[model samples]
Target: MNYLLRLLTILFLTNLSASANVITLQSTQDSLAKYSIPELIGKAEVTKDSVYLNYLEKKDLSTEELANVLYMHGNILINEGIMDRSRQYFERLDSVAKILKDPFYQFVSKLSIGEVYYRQKNYPASKESFESAHPFVAQFPEGIQRALAKAEYVYFYYLNGQFERYSKELEGIKKELIDLGEQGKVGDEDLDYLEMSKATVSVYLTKAYLMNEDFSKAEEELKYSDKILKERFHNKITTTAVQQKLTKGEFYFFKKDFKMAIPYFQEVNKLGDSENFGDFQYVARVMASIAYFQLADYKQSLSFSEAAMNHPIPIADYIDYEVEAMRYAYLASKELGLSDKAMQYSQKFLEQDEALKDTKRSNFINSILNNMEVSQLENDLIAKTKSNYVLRYSLIGLAILIVILVLFTVYQIRENKHNKEKIREFMHNLEESDKAEKAKQEERRISKANAEINSDTPAQPDDKTVKILDKLEEFESSDLYTDSKMSLSYLASYLGTNTITLSKIINTYKEMNFNDYINGLRIRFIIEKIKNEPKFEQYKISYLAEVSGFSSHSIFSKAFKKSTGVTPSQFLDFLKEDTR
Candidate 1:
């Protein structure tokens, strides 16, 4: 049995490596490319170098041919789970396409980049990239490329868990593809390609629909994929494996048949590691834990949860291992009457939870601003280099000016001209060195001040507000509220004072409610940043609000309007207009 298990692991690894070699360059002939998918699933050894050779020998290729080569390179890399590399190829292709002035390449490139980020599980980055590109799909004059880019975006958005955006794109892509085909603007090959791609996208849409709990739509979309697979493709080895696994998993998950879902999850896990991260394995583990817990199988639930925490794949902060696992560990231990183990687990969990709170972004920023201490001695080397640059430049300029003055005074004092010149040069050089040294010191002071002011660090009521604001003078800094979720109780606890005392302090000094006081601080900070720091002008108003402790964009906007009697954007425009 052990020997058989070893063999199974090897086979799984081999299967994944083979799957990673799947190629998808647009340069391949339509007929040949259509068969490649099936052949690849059959473990055919088709590689990217072979595709490159085929294209390289073609002497008289059009702009379309080059674009296709780049598309293929990007596709293979993406399939193989190398996102950063795939992004580079797609970005290059986009540039080429833009140079050719083809909207198809432009849209396709954007769609490809978004898909890469989606696979990498960077949903925010993926959403931003796709939304930026989606607007161009409608403006592209008339091209099959536009339809293809739209379809790609729709498919990947579904993967990114943006079901609403996915559905909207789906409706738009279907309509446009049909309209283009009916008008005879797109060729037959292009139409077939769209059909095949859309079917693939539908598979994901089915998954998304199921996830959204729209069972009827999920079933309908899966059926459509099934029909396309049966009618268009001759072989179904690998595609069948993926489709069956997905369908079974979703079906069981949606039905809440946790026990029934176990087998499918097991099958997916047994498939071995793919060239890509075994995300499905982790997913299965998480779901199995959930299922076991639901079925009252505490031991199995704890075991599965532990396995998930150990999985090599790293997800975002959506879940943390220590927190989730410790919860299960404590509960399971207590239920099993292991009192000693339960206490140990609970203690560990508390310590880790405290660490997380301290590391939260807002808290970190607050610490920085409150400290107001630069590691000057630690940055001595960097400061020395900067000072040297100023010293060197100033000395050179002073030497030149002194030389000019000496030459001008040469005719006036012929007897003592050389002596006077020496004295003048020495004095001039000394003056320049002193000036440069002072300038460098001033620069460091200004940088330290800016760092303090730029910080959205929370302030404690116990700290002298006068001293805090005094430090702002060097850089003309202003305070922005740094804590959005901060409450009076929390503040009072931190400051070693009651809410009433803090309220009185603010009322007497700042003359405003907590809300208005915070907003006023933010508005002042924003204005100072815009006027003094050029780069702050580029930051979105929404980001500024977050940095300033506004909980949401709407609240930030309302506060800005109330404080300045103008929106943030309007304020920015006014600043720009004044500068102009």
Candidate 2:
């Protein structure tokens, strides 16, 4: 009786295991049905938790089902940007396929692992993964899987700049696909997937042809892939379509047909907008901005470049795009006469360039124009347009100039009012500080009296002298020294004091006559301006003198040299050097 009971118990446990395996397998199949293999191939939408849960629930599945489920889980993880976790799933699938003696699954697992590495930009690891899968190609029967594996290998070769190897492998892949079709071994579903593979292969081939300067061949391949995508796939929003547009845009851009390239790049951007296409969107924006810039549409170029720089992805993830965007932004801003913005973008570009200095990617950027080249181009453009600009402005009437003068007067009036408010606030703060200091002094005097002791000290300034000195400091801080027409009487009246007391205080405390003091302040202000405003270095000496409150450039230059041990031009050169 006991032996019979144990036998039944073991049989029941076995059946329960079988039942659980069936349930899990069914769930995995259901999940996969929602997302086909073709959809999973490129930038597919995936819920990581749902896919992973299906994998976890799977139990005692057949070898093929187990491998498929595992591959699906890894592919979902890859799409979700969980690369490390995806690698683990692919590795597990590889091990399982090895154990089951299934070369097809093994090849696919290895290929998926390579794709993960490729997305991470781990070129060496990705290449090794592809190499490992190459040995299993013969074991893979002629079908969609084999075609995909071959396409992936070709793409890897193309990306690594192994164009010769890419060409050889791609020919073999094309011949094999043609033979498969003639053999009638590919059904409707398999043919659909094969078309996707062909489209991808065409994209890589197009890129290779472009890189080799074979424009005619590149265009042929591009049109072929685009037609196949539209006719068969109905121009669906797939990775193949996105890549095709990108390749076309790049083709036209390199050929200097920027207007022709813009539409292609825009199509790519629109497609990638809904998916996290990982650098494709970034490249699209950058290329579009470049095309617009080359077409001399500064506003559109600036807009696109700004969009690229402020993409949702972290800038660090796409440093190359960030650098390119900054370049276009600088160029556009400079052309649009946004001097301050141009300088800011240029500074950012330099900083990003410095960070990439020791990287292999730096060589790629170096292929583009450098800072000096861009600056020279800007200068040349300015020189070429200067006469036209002067002629355009000269056609305007004196009424426009008078209107500008009136506007400037209004601005000056508003600025003076703002400055007066700021001065009032500063004076209030100083009064508070003075009261606190007086409280401390009184406390000390009381302490001395309580101790019945007296000490001799120099007398402090009289109240009137102290008030004048405080007002003078306030006037200087308020930038009233920048007023070329300022006079002692005018300032003293503004301070509610007489000019003689103000002059006496200024001479006694500042140790300089009124004119010398004002000149020193202006010199200091201009030096600070040169340090802060990069555009200031480009100004003429006369303009500098006009803005710095001097009547003549000679006096301004002399005062600047006496105060800072450098002439204005010398100081400007120093600032330029420091920026570089």
Candidate 3:
């Protein structure tokens, strides 16, 4: 019985190993037979190079098949962060495709080369490669491939900071997609690819808008992309989701909401890891480092910054993020008193910054700068004339009135000179009397302080009064005054004191009644909020009043005027002027 059982186990083990071999063989054959070059390249983006290469080497292939394999290999190397080796594969494929007269493959190879250049921050070379492929890609029939090529061009434009060109190209591609659908050329499968491409393009556009600080438009594009991705690609669209999260994180980062930005960046890193989104993963790490640094979590900031810096993949094209990571790492190390690490990171940061300064001297950036300069000049001219037609007309009429008034002013100046001397004499006499009155007031204030100090029995606070004052200070520090419904009774209960004591303390220390004290705190809080958050200036008077704990706009306006010697609107205007 033992011998029989041993034989059965051996047979089972043998069969299991045989079955695994068969499955592996079948997978290799299926990959070689079933996938197109483009599909294989897409697969290379997510799969391990070893697995892809194992299958790719198993099959005997034709020249075209060899070219496709080479392309996939190059893409795998790129994913593995081996750029020099990847470029060799791409160059070989380009040559093979040209010899084979495969325009599609040729265009794809050129685009790949351009992507390599882009990743290297060689913008001129990247632009040249992309331009060389454009005509070849355009010669293809209107289909998913053509649309994808056009979208790639738009992405290139965006990366180069040609936002106007990116916008125009995106609109043109969108119109072309609509036209394609209207012509009934888009079958169901074609529709799927088209929608995916559109969604991908929208994600890029969202990032572009974010970089330009157009938050509303960025949000619109993100929503649009997410909708299409959900309806079509569903959970499979990990890259788009990662891009959306990164853009959203960037938006909040710019808004100085570091707490909000951190979660989005963390989500992007999580998704990127799970989905093997190599590029976005590094970007998310860098952004998380920045957010953590901004939040003053030096340890967390250093962790993320070091992760980004040590990433095998080159994120050099994202020069800003690269410099920021170095800067954050330097700052975190310096804060932690790691002098050696801090000096190392600081040196790296300075080196990268200097390199970036040189890169920024590129014609592409110069063009952008020149365009911005021209835009500013045009804006200034428009502002000088006033954008509104009515305002322009009013200004012109005011100018004519000013000219007439100037003529009258010259004649009046001679007649008024003698009258002005008489008026000045009377004003000087009033000033002297005012100075004497202020001196008397100052003396009276000193006399009161002296009387209080010299009194035989000076008033002193008892234990209960001291306790109440301490609790009142705590209440004020707690921001309870910002609560619209907070009353003397409510605050007194919160502080474990009677309303009478609370009111007495407030009147004695603050020199104001409960209502006046609360209103004063609320007004001060609102002013600080407005100063810190410029967007608060755009709020309506009622909204501002409500947020500042007022029951009504009228009450708020009256209190604000009394406390500030200016109405709320006037105060807001003053804030705006100060900001300018």
Candidate 4:
């Protein structure tokens, strides 16, 4: 549970660059872009403010320039932990974007606003802002910005604990970005940005994969992160250095390798920003405190916990808002025999534990209620402005379109029926031979069973595999395997075998890898239902795929075709024709 917060924040950083990378990178000179946000640290605040003021004072800036300034200023403020001021700039950007009909700025503005609300612990507003930005995803020209926009939403999905959406959105990001590159929509300079961004995405995906408990994927993402960073930045970039060390620490920390994680945490603490009052100083300290506490080094744990307490932890990272330092401090102090300090820490932890939790939830609820204020205004305006002629014409057009669709659908249905007749003719041609073959197979099976039943003794390592097969027979009688998340580990848990042994059994007996085996079962199950159930005959192809345990309709279609020599729709149509 303690690691959950750490896990989510780590997932957010590589994707949410506008919040400055989950929040902000500590001040640095290495520019990721013309207006790259460097996290404001100590004296760096003055320089950032001066830049913000300069942008404000300048009068001759063009629309793009002004939008860039506003976006940068908002990012700077958000990174500096200035939520109110950040929200103002983003709102201003949103207004300007709407006036200029610039969806890019509109998207950026909403995304930044979401980050601000997220950092402010206003989850509902954050979610709303992210959703608002979603429509603008396709509005950007195909390039890094568009990919990044989708990636930013991926961060939100991950942090909101929507792992399925997170994984899907993440795959979309990779595909879109890589596709853009392959299509030559990206130049060399753009390639550099893409590479770095991909590395960042890979880094965060480790946390996302870990959250879904896909340890193998997590490890793969982590290793890819290391490889990409070494090739691109070579640990020279300050943010890169910090993120790499921090992510490694988090990875090991989540693995419960407290001792293994310590060195990486130490490395992060050595980084320029995490040393002083950088954004991650509190994170490093709090996590280090927890790690040490886990190691039973109470004195060191208490020291780090108190150090964490001394800093203002931002809401950008997990557990930062509620401040886990006090919880560990209480335990560490007690372990160290410091009764007075332990009591004080315990009381503070208790106060924060529930109070912060409730405050976050209530803030989200309040935002939700407050959001209804003027939403109907636009609807009312649209309603008033619509003339009867316009409405009538629109309705007429819609009716025409519906008629066209119905005619086309009817034509398609006739064509399908024709195809079905041909298929039936082919089946009828083979029906006699198929019946003969089936009769022969049934005879052979019955003879084998009769011979086995007449045996005096039953078969006894045949023992465990046979036993497992029996349980599997029982299991296959139910719909449990229809769960979309019926992974190897999950099946192992149900079968009472370790994952290793289960894999062996599946490979030996099922004659396929785990994924293929599950998919095979799903296809067979759906085919059986389609054959026997009249209601299921009316089920949409995608819905059938889902009920049959596929996460994607495309995948289900492919698998079904491979297994049965026809698409699900084709097979279902065939079944309908056969029954008639």
Q: TM-scores of all models?
A: 0.40, 0.49, 0.54, 0.54
User: Candidate 1 or 2, higher TM-score?
Assistant: 2
lDDT of 1 by residue, 298-379 (tens): 7887677667666534322123434545545555555566767656665565565565552222122112122111111112
RMSD of each: 21.7, 25.2, 25.2, 21.4
Runs in model 1 lying further than 4 Å from the true structure: 1-86, 100-104, 115-127, 135-146, 155-165, 171-195, 238-244, 270-289, 296-580
Candidate 3 has its poorest 10 consecutive residues by lDDT at: 1-10
Worst 10 residues of 4 by lDDT: 1-10
Which of the two, 1 or 4, has more TM-score?
4
Candidate 3 Cα errors over 4 Å, as ranges? 1-48, 54-59, 316-319, 359-580
Ranking by lDDT: 3, 2, 4, 1
lDDT of 2 by residue, 119-202 (tens): 566767988988898888777555655665566545656656555677667767766766777888777645665566666667
Model 2 segments beyond 4 Å from truth? 1-105, 112-122, 183-185, 275-279, 312-323, 326-580
Q: lDDT per residue, candidate 3, 1-580, as tens digits?
A: 0111111222222222333323322243454557654344334333434565546556666787677677667766776678788778889889998898887668778877877777666778878988887778666666655765666655667666566677778767766766777788877645655575567667666666654546788778878888987887677644556677787787787656789989988887787677666767787888788678767798999999998898846643433567767767877887788878876786686677667664332222112212222212222333333534666588687769877787887876664554445434534654675577457446545655665788754455655766676666566566778787776657777878754456657777666776678887787778778879989999999998999888778778877776666577766765676567
Clashing pairs for predicted structure model 1, backbone only: 25-72, 366-457
Clash counts for the predictions, in order: 2, 0, 0, 2
lDDT (Cα, tens digit) per residue for candidate 4, span 1-580 = 1122122222222232334323333345444234423333212232344443343435456665566567657766655667898799989989889888887678778877887887777879988988998898798666766666667666776656566678777766777767777888877645656666676666666766655557678788778768877877684543544665777787777667789888887766656353342555567777788788777798999998897687554555433423467767777887788878866776676666555664223222112122221222223223434544586689688869977887998898897777677655644644664477457546544655665788644433254665676567667678898998676667777888655456667766666666677887787688668767789999898999999988777778877766655677887777876778
* Candidate lDDT values, in order: 0.55, 0.65, 0.65, 0.64
